[model samples]
Target: MARKGGELEAFIAFLGGLLAAGLAALAMAGIGLAVRPTPALKSAALVTLGAIWLTVTTTVYLRIKPRSS
Candidate 1:
């Protein structure tokens, strides 16, 4: 069904990616803030979480996005 409407499919994928990434970021931030570790540890934790978030988001986006014909 999605294959027939390429542009619309792509747009949907874009929105999905944005939503997924945003939610992931918020979750990570909440976790980091809730823990309230030492400054150095907090920095390291947030950085690690951010990297994981980016990787997951990009993977999702690529998996959902349609390829050019």
Candidate 2:
């Protein structure tokens, strides 16, 4: 039972990280578009920002641990 609860908590944390990463990516993309007027530069900026966001999110998710109860 305790193991199951821990798994559930981890799953929830993972989902939350995913949602946060997605929202952040959208915001970054918008900023990239506004900052870079040229199409190529905008695309590059968006991709770079997206990759960075994903990497950070994944690292954070992996570091999350269930609390003792």
Candidate 3:
């Protein structure tokens, strides 16, 4: 059954995105700390993580949101 898009759906998507992005960021931080990654590597990682977060969040939000007729 198709569900109507509303505040609840948006909230769920936001929450899911946060969880996914947060975990990934934590993992990257852990690895960076453990290995003492180079500055260049660190910069790259930050950029990558930012991209991942944005992409995941936007994608989730869009996917969860129903299109208007």
lDDT of each: 0.65, 0.66, 0.80
| Ranking of all candidate structures by their lDDT, best first | 3, 2, 1
Evaluate residue 54 in candidate 2 and report its C-alpha lDDT on the 0 to 100 scale.
Answer: 66
Per-residue error at 55 for model 1, in Å? 0.5
RMSD of each: 4.7, 4.1, 3.2
| TM-score-better candidate, 2 vs 3 | 3
Clashes of each: 0, 0, 0
Model 1, 1-69: lDDT tens per residue? Answer: 435535665566556656766776687678767886688976776676566655665666577666776
- Candidate 3 stretches with Cα past 4 Å from truth are 1-11
Writing each residue's lDDT as its tens digit, candidate 2 over 1-69 gives 556345755666666666766787787677766775687866876676567656765666567765565
Model 1 root mean square deviation, Cα atoms: 4.7
Candidate 3 lDDT tens digits, 5-43? 578777777777778778988998888778978989978
Clashing pairs in 3: none
Scored against the true structure, residue 9 in model 1 reaches a CA lDDT of 50
- TM-scores, all candidates, are 0.47, 0.49, 0.67
Model 2 clash pairs are none
Best candidate, lDDT: 3
Task: Please say which candidate is ahead in TM-score: 1 or 2.
Answer: 2
